[model samples]
Target: MMRRRLLYWITALGLGTLILASTGYAQTLSQQVLNLLARTNTWTADQTFDNLTITGVCTGCGGAGGGTVTSVAMTVAPAAIFDIGGTPIVGAGTLALSLDTQANNLAFMGPNGGGPSVPA
Candidate 1:
């Protein structure tokens, strides 16, 4: 329910901004969209992990562990607003994504695992 509500709000906010821009209140709709994207700090998302391997590394300690077949959580942040040459590009926004965690979100894992304890 919470996830649904959050998604609804995000969609509503985006759509509302687009509508405002489209109605010629200020800037172009496309530019407004770009500005919105460029202004967001970070957005996170959850995803399934199927046949994917994650690697862990410890510098100086020379310890590493990695495996395959698990779950994945992802977070993305806005990249540098300016270009490599220190020039601010017009209407350019990009996201830098990082896979935060790996585990399973299946029915067998119970409610904590992301699924119901029993089949619904």
Candidate 2:
């Protein structure tokens, strides 16, 4: 009886760890948007959000200053979102904004190909 109980406890503990490793705490949509904005070589971060939708301007992406950001947003995650003055480089034929908070950095590929921006 004792051996059986010990085995059950061990199995339960392992299962719990598996679940945590798989599904971490949820990320707000706004935060994800801000991350996309900061990566641009041109645009400066006007605002940040948790949702996928973003609104920003581009005045110093790479040029002296000529871009304007009246508003920025997308119905869904766009292929890419560059800074106010940044150029949107297409990766893997498209752009995809993804986020992973697994303590390890997430790969924010333009579409779908590459490793994490940071090792985390």
Judging by lDDT against the true structure, name the best candidate: 2
The clash numbers for all candidates, in the given order, read 1, 26
Model 1, CA-based lDDT: 0.31
Give stretches of model 1 more than 4 Å off.
1-92, 100-109, 113-120
Q: Write the per-residue lDDT of candidate 2 for residues 1-120, one digit (tens) a residue.
A: 455432111101111111111233323334433345345434332333332222333222345568645443333333243222222433323334443233356454565575567766
Residues 1-120 of candidate 1: C-alpha lDDT, one tens digit per residue? 455432111111222122222233322245444434545433222211232111211112324786653333323343332223213333454433443333467222445557546767
lDDT of each: 0.31, 0.32
Question: Which 10 consecutive positions of candidate 1 have the poorest summed lDDT?
Answer: 51-60
Per-candidate TM-scores read 0.12, 0.12
Choose the strongest candidate by TM-score: 1
